[model samples]
Target: MIKHDVSHFPTILVFNTTEKDKTSVALIKNGSVKISEKSRRAQELQSIVEELIDNNHIEIGEIKAVAVLEGPGSYTGIRIGATTGNTLHWLYRMPVIVIPGTDISEAAERLMSGEEFDVTTYFSPRD
Candidate 1:
């Protein structure tokens, strides 16, 4: 249970399952990342959600929106994360925003440099 003060911002839940090393679920508030959990197994999805819920990191009703990584990579991983996000959005009547995995890198680059940058990123299949 990791706790941080994010009371001034809208809570956004983000799930990324595009690549193994980069797979993660994060909570963002006021333009800063708050809580983040990363894992490789698809099975860890439930635990990740439970961890967020159990810790009171995000209140169900207070979730402003949900963001999911819509991928051109792991089909199963993307589906798992999307399903979770969709279910939550439907259950709580929150808006769901789908962001492609590639865009996330681009966004990070823009944020850091304050300028647009071009970069290539992808996920390779497991043996």
Candidate 2:
């Protein structure tokens, strides 16, 4: 039995696959983003996680859930982030939540407007 003392605030791991040139993962604790980073390759993802853990002084076991960008972007980027999130979830028994990048943008728009707005997202491969 592993004992984890996750703070009562929400903790989220956000991944972005919106652009091939830019991939990012963010760690949010208590509604505050503690760490955010970008990497280009799958091999670099783990290192970013390690850096976040080290820099934020957080334990891997302390993460309560993972919030990953589900896609409509680079397939390989999504796979990399999803694989990493899933692995962590399996190892720590934490919850995994997925949010599309469009949804995030829509939410931001709604917050800014204080009114509901129709939102649509499209993705196309880069040639």
Q: What lDDT tens digits, residue by residue, belong to model 1 across residues 1-127?
A: 1222223336666677766555666665556664445655655876775676567655667776666666677777777767777777667765555554534444322223333222112212221
* Candidate 2 residue-pair clash tally: 0
Clashing pairs in 2: none
Question: Which residue pairs show backbone clashes in model 1?
Answer: none
Q: Pick the candidate with the highest TM-score.
A: 2
Q: Which ten residues in a row have the lowest lDDT in candidate 2?
A: 118-127
- Across 1-127, the per-residue lDDT of candidate 2 in tens digits comes to 1222223326655556555766566777664665354646545777777877788888887777665566677678777767776777777776555454634343222223323222112222221
Question: What TM-score would you give candidate 1 relative to the actual structure?
Answer: 0.64
What residue runs in model 2 are displaced by over 4 Å at the alpha carbon? 1-9, 102-127
- lDDT (Cα) of model 2: 0.56
